[model samples]
Each structure stands twice: as C-alpha cells, then as structure tokens.
Target: MAAKRPVDRPRPTLLIILAAALTLLTLQFRGLQPLDAFQQGVRDIVEPVRSLSDRLTDPVQTAWNGVFGFEALRLENERLEVELARMRGNALTSEADTELLNRLLSEVDIAYSDFDAVVVRILGQPPGNFSSHMIEVDKGTDDGIEEGMAVVTGAGLVGRLEQVDRSRSLVQLATHPDFRVGVRLVTSQDEGLAKGTGTEGILRIESGVRLDAQVDNDEVLVTSGGRSLFPGDIPVGKVLDPDSDADYRRSIIIGLAADLENLSFLKVVLPAEKPEGMR
Candidate 1:
C-alpha cells in the first residue's frame, strides 16, 4: 500500500508509446483522417480566442494604414494640382494667340497693296549676346519665303528674312549690324539711313546735313520708300540720343519700336509690284 509498483509505471509508458506509434502508422498509411478530424475539433475550440485577438488589434492596424497611406495620397494630390495649373496657363495662351492671329491677318490682307503674305512661327532663338534681336522662323522657300523678304509682327516691323532654306529661314533683326534701311524722322523732318548696331534696341543714323543741322530726342522714325525689302512709311524706331559733336559726321542713336525678344508669330510680306508711273 505504501510503495508503487514498477509494472504499473511500465504499463502506462508502453501504452503511450504504442498509442504514438499507432498514430504515426495511421498517418503514413491512411493519410491522416483521424488527425484531421482532431484538428477540426481544436479549431472549433480556438475560434473565439482568435476573434478576440483580432478585435483587440483592429485600432492599431487601422492607425498603421493611415500613417503609410496618407503620404502617397498627398503626393498624388499635389501632382494633380500642378497639372491643373499648367493646363490652365496653356489655355489662356491659346486664346490670346488666336485673337492676335485674327487681327493681324485681317489688317494685312486689306492694307497691303499688291503683296501676298505668309504667317510663320518662330522656331529657334538667337544667342543672348547677339542682343536677342534676331530669330529663326519655320517657313522658308518651301512656303515662298525667300531672302530679303520683310518680316513684320502685329505691333511693328520685326526684321528681314536673311538666309532661306527649304523649310527654315533666318531673320536678321532691325538691330543687326548689316541692316540698313532708309528712314525719315518725323519730328525733325530729317531723312537718313537707319542702320543696325548689332545690339538690342539700338540703331545708328548717319545724317547728311550741314554743320547748321540740329535735331532733338524722341523723334519718330519711319521707313523710307527707298528700301527694297521693307514697306515704305512703316514705323521703325524712335531717336534716343543725338551726337555731341554736330560739326563732324553726326551719328544719332535710336531705340527700336518693337519688342524683338518675345516674337511668337510673324508675317513675311512678299515683294510688291511696281506701279505704272514715270517709267
């Protein structure tokens, strides 16, 4: 009664070993049917516990999602806003361009005497050190734009077509060093050669007057009829400074009337026919 028997302990251990061996043999032969049934029973018991665990952790998972997802959402919103602003700017520019083209085409078709005109878009810009006066247009001999053709904008005279290719033309602005046009000063009633200085807004006038000649600033200058390229009586520039020494050959500086830097559209005026007079 006081001592436990060794046979009892051995019997329990043998029974446990026999049970484990039988379970393994059954799994190997019959594909674990009994074990699957036992696992299903265990799942039924643990389902409530798993549900409780998920409920306890729901707020933490939600907060983690908000922290990570908010960054991507904010970046997407910023990109959309920037795209909207860019499209709006493009729309406004398109409207302004349409209005300008309508006005220029109508005015040129009616006012010009015997010359046909072709509108051209500026493709490339000249170097900045070249006074930003000259530009390249997208039209050339293919569009009937040839060398020595006059280029003008809605505001005033822009330049002259210098070199022409099959599809492109180089425009030498009124400020080019090689540019010379006959101009008449309105205020002084003085006629002189308006020549370019290769600098922005600068033109030089070589007056052929005598030592008694005198002129003031802010004089309105217009193109003379003697020029072969540009039209006659077109507004060109305004006088800025007169020569200090009037006794010598006086060279007056003039400022161009047009903004050559921001030329988007221009028209090339074809050569006009000579009128039948005194021939």
Candidate 2:
C-alpha cells in the first residue's frame, strides 16, 4: 500500500469570524457577567496607551499654533506702523498749512490797512543779476499790481514794484544800491535820505542835520513822505551808529525793519486810484 496521503487543513473563513463576533455581541446583550469582565480587561489595557499618545501630541499642537500666532502678530504690528507714519505725515502738513494761513491773514490785518493792497506770494528770487536785489511775486497787472507800487510787510517797507507782467511782478528790495527814501529821526529834528547800500542788513542815512546834532543810538527813523515815494510814518529802521569817516560824516548806519533774507509774503500797495480787491 502506498503511504497514506496527508490531508490539507482548511483555512479560517469570513463565516467563522462573523459567527464568533455575533456570539460575543449576544452574550454582552444578555448581560453575561463574564463578558463584562473581559471587556473591562481590554479597556484597561488600551486606555493608558491612548492617554500617552494624546499627551505627546498636545505640546506639538500648542507649539505649532504659537508659531502661526507669532507670525500673525508680527504682520499686524507692521501694518499699524505703516498707518501711523502716514497719519503723522498728514498731521505735519496740516500744521504747516495752518501756520502759513495765519501769517498771511495777519499781514492783511496789520500792515496794509491804510491802502488798497494786493497780497502776493513771493515766488522766488529773481534770476541772474537781479537775484540779490530783487524777488518775484505772483501777482501783476491782472491783479492791479503795477510798477512803482510800494511793497511792504507787516514790519515795514520792503521795496517797490520794479517790473510788472500780466500775472507776475518783480520787486526791487529796499537794500538795492539805487533805492532811496526820505526819512526823519523820531527823537530829533533831523531829516535825511535813507539809501540802500546794496549790502544785507545795512542802510545809510545822509542827513542835512548838523554833525553835532544829538542823534543817539537806537533812534527810530520814519518815512517823511517828502517826494511821495512812500507814505509818512512807516518805520524804516533804528540808528546803529553815526559814522565819522571822512567820506560819510553826515551818514549813519542802521538796521532794517524788515527781514529781507527770509521774506515770504508781501503786500503791493495799489495806486491811489485803483479800487480795492483781492486776487
């Protein structure tokens, strides 16, 4: 007889698994005490591992959230800084504009009240040879400004309008070498011709008063309106010294009332016949 052939063992099947799971479920449903004890043992073995996994992941989740939050905060801070810079720039601009407006209004109210005058912006210094002695203004014939009109500031006379265009004018500052005005000493009976020296902050008074006249230091000078070049009583300057030099014995040095180097706004006094209006 040939050796008996070995029989193959059958593999476990899905039907067997289904039957086992159904039997456990039925026992638990019937409240079998032994099944409850087995379920409790499974939970006790798995619960600690589940809790350890949750604890490990919690810190990592928190760190990740913190990194993203830091980035968000950085972006928000940058946005706020940009907005603040823009607002600061706007505030500075508004303050500058308000200050300029107040200054212009004060010029109108205080200085040019005696005559119909045009308030003009000093555009800039004139170009080339005239730059040191003259400035350009933004109003001209169209604004009723004309050559020879007196230009002044709140402080006192600045110059006369030298040239006029349709919409612009040139001013010859009072310090020009060719400029001259009649002036009188406020404290003394001395009358003189106040003349520009073509130099900054200096004027020459060639008076007919005797050299021995008591013209003290800091004596005020005012326009005499002799030739009608300027109105009477406008403050010109205060005496600085009576030069005793051989060539300038009758002359004295004085400081100007108006600050020419920092001129900003001007008023052009209209001719006596021109009607009052603003540009």
Candidate 3:
C-alpha cells in the first residue's frame, strides 16, 4: 500500500498528436476545403512575421549570390573588352588598307605613268635626319630596277636608285643633302636645277631663276630632260615662295611633291630617253 504505482506516461497525448498530424496531412492531400481554410487563417495571422523575417534574410542571400557570381562577371567583362580592342584594331587596319588602295589607283594619273616599271615595297628607311636618307627597296637588278632609275609614288618623284643588288636596291631620296636634279618651272618654263640645300626636305634653285622671270608661289617644277638623273616632265615639287635678293634674283624654295615619310608601295621606273613636253 505504501509503494506508489509507476507514474503513467502520456502515451495517449503522443498518439493524439500523431493522429492529428496524419489527419491534417491526409485532409490536405485529399483537397478538403476546411484544412485549406485553416491554413489560410494561420498564414494570415503569421504572414507579417514571415515577411519581416524574409526581409531580414534577403540581403544576406543576395550578398552570397553576388560573391559567388563576381568572378564570372569579371571574366565576361574582360572578354568583352578584348573583343572590343580587336575590333578597333581591325578597323584601323582596314582604314590603312583603303588608303593604300587609293594611292595605287591614283598612281595611274602621274605624268610619267606610261613608263615601264616595277611595283616595289619598301624594306627599310633612314632612321633620322643625320642618316644617309637612303631607303631600301625590295626590287633590284632582278626586277630591272637599276642604278639612276626613278622611284616614285602617286604623289610624284621621291627618290632614285643608286645602290643596286640582285634582289634589292638602295634609293637616294630627293631630300638627301647631296641630291640634285635639273628642274624647269611649269608656269614660267624657266629651266633651273633643283638642288638639295643640306636642310631637311628642302631644295633651292639659287642660280636659274632670272631677275626678270615671273615666278610666284606654288609654281610646279618638273625634271628637265637633258642631263637630269630622272626623266623629264616627272613632276618633282612645287615652289613655296622664293627668297629674293636686291637684284630680284631669288633662291627658290621647293616643297617636295611626294610625302617621303609615308612611302609604302612605289613604282621604280626604268630610265628612258627624256620626253619633251611643257605646259
């Protein structure tokens, strides 16, 4: 009578709770409206708290996603930047090619365009003003580019072949300090010599321009036929206003017709008997 009975465990309470959970799951699965209504009511009661909790956790989830995606995004940006630079380089190359094509087409209109020639690429050029100023061309005796032959572009005469090899030639640019060529004025028909003045890309006619000769700025000069290293009527340069003395005898300054610095492709004309013509 003194020993108490073992305390009864709440087995029925656990069984009741399990039964309720199973009943709720079965009713939800069976598409009963009452369970759904209860669910809705519960959701309505707790929705604000759920929303607040989600708001608090949303920034953390987004930060995790950004950290994981940043490397991929950076790689994609680098790829795009490389592609853009490549496109820009291609555009620049295309533009340069177009310019060369235009120059080749315009060469046909040069005064000595009828001369038999070879189209040669430049291999090298003088590095500075102090250098020999002789450019190397890809054509030589093999291509019939001989000594004293003219090297010209669409713009006009730029050089003459002096050092010839079997496969290549060295061209003495007209701007060279030792360069000299007989010249005749196009407008006045005054015969003169275009002599390099030892200055960079400058030529002067210190002797030929007569005091009485009517010469003005931008006067065209062509190679004089007789003893000139180049052919006659090959436009060499244009006169930029001359320097006059007391007797009005002038040292005519000539601006080179060809842009020597930009030579790419050029025509090496075989020397021929000088043609006679004047405007």
Candidate 4:
C-alpha cells in the first residue's frame, strides 16, 4: 500500500499578528501618539542593557586580541628600557666632564711662574704594580714635549716627562722612589736634595741640607734653579711635622702639592729661550 504524505498546515493567527504589527507601524508614522509613547518606553528600557553589553564586550575583545600580541608588547618594553639606560649614562658622563673641565690651566698662575707651557690631558697610568708612579699623557714630540720637561697641574708640580713618542708621553711622577728634585725652604733658605720615599704622596730630604738645618713644620718647599732639573720657585710641597731622630737626622715627610691619584688636566713646560746670544 502507498502511504500519502501529511499535508502542511498554515495557521491564520501568525498572519493576523503580522498584519496588526504592520498596521501599527503605519499608524505610528502618521501621528499615532500612543504607539509612539509605547516605542519610546521600549527603547528607554533596552538602551541601558545595550550600552552595558557594549562596555563589557569591548574589554573582553581587546583582551583576547592582546593575548596574541603579548610578545610584541614585551619586546617593545625591553627596547624602551635600554634606551632609558643609555640616556641616563650619557647624562652622568656629561656631568663628570663638566667637573673635570673646572680643573683647567686658568685655575693656576703658570704665567707668573715663568713656564712656557702647553696644556694636555692625562691618558692613564702605566699598567704595572711597579709602574704605579707614572702617568701617560696625550702629547709628545709632535706637541713640542721633550724628555725631562716638567709636568704640572693647577695645584702644583705633578712629575717629569719620561718616555717620549710622536703623539704621547709618559710622566714619571714625583712619587717614584728614584725621583729627585732640589728644593729650598721658603722661610729658612735651607737647600736640600728631595727624594721620594716610595711612600704614597710623600717625599723627604735625603741629603744636601745638614741634620742641624733649621727646618720647621708646615714650612713651604720650593725648587732651587741652580743645576736643578726643574725651574726655580715652583712650589713642590709643604713639610709635615718633622720626626726627630735621637742622633741620625730629622725624618721629614713632604705632602705633595698636586693630587696625583686623581689627575685630569696637565701642562708641559717648554725650555726657556736663551737671551739673544746663548741660543
């Protein structure tokens, strides 16, 4: 037996409701006050929920997108951190250079001391435990610096020029054990051979002046020009309180005038020109 298919049924209720809705929309457009008021009320009630949904969904959508871009954000932050560090380092270096320039030749009276000088900067110390009493400089024969030239700072004498190159020179500091300078007492006029004790920043009169010489505490010592390596009247150091020996001699320690440990700028003394005939 062949089975017949069930007939599809259409109800008039849905059709009637749709026709009513259409009639209401047409009347609303044609100055239907009640329907307009009803639509207004419906919009007012739904608007808050719609706005709340938009607010909530926006952040969630943004967070979902951000999860995929987290590595890019982290990399960007690291790059910013490096840039900030480099800027900070440059600021500190600028401040340090400003302070170093304050210690320039203008701070001292080199012209009053009879030195024909050229300004230079200290490069570094020689690399050895034994060579701690030397400093390398940025000028040499090319800059008219010669061996045995006096090296000085604004405060006072630093050392003498040692090894000379075309563009660089080594300064043998006054603190070296073999260093020697003829110095005279500013008050008593006593002259002596001043030698480094290998002690840090200290020198002593090894000989030349008698043990009974009138040396006083805090007395100023200056260079003696006759046959001396350095010119006369350059301030060398101040005598500390002399240590009295029972019989041998007074142990005198001189505090160096220049701060050798933190040198920055320096001057090399050129030889004085002979007076018209000795040249």
Whole-model lDDT values for every prediction: 0.70, 0.73, 0.73, 0.72
Tell me, by TM-score, which candidate is best: 4
lDDT of 3 at 81: 100
> Cα RMSD (Å) per model?
32.8, 39.2, 36.5, 37.1
What digit string (tens of lDDT, one per residue) describes model 1 on residues 44-131?
A: 4664564576568768867886898789778878987997899887998868754654453344332432346789988666335653
TM-scores across all candidates?
0.52, 0.54, 0.55, 0.56
- Candidate 2 — what's its lDDT? 0.73
Better of 1 and 3 by lDDT: 3
The TM-score that candidate 3 achieves is: 0.55
Please list the residue runs of candidate 4 whose C-alpha ends up more than 4 Å from where it truly belongs after superposition. Answer: 1-112, 127-130, 244-246, 274-279
Candidate 1 to truth, TM: 0.52
For model 3, where is the 10-residue window of minimal lDDT? 101-110
Off by over 4 Å in 1: 1-116, 126-133, 209-211, 274-279
Error of 3 at 278 (Å): 29
Tens digit per residue, CA lDDT, model 3, 1-279: 666558755688789999999998998899898876675566456645645865698798779868997897788789989979998879978687556534533443334667767899886653356457688776656566667877888767887886666555678888887777888876677888787765656788877768678887766677776767677777787788666443755688999888876467889876664345410
Worst 10 residues of 1 by lDDT: 104-113
Task: Output the better candidate (2/4) by TM-score.
Answer: 4
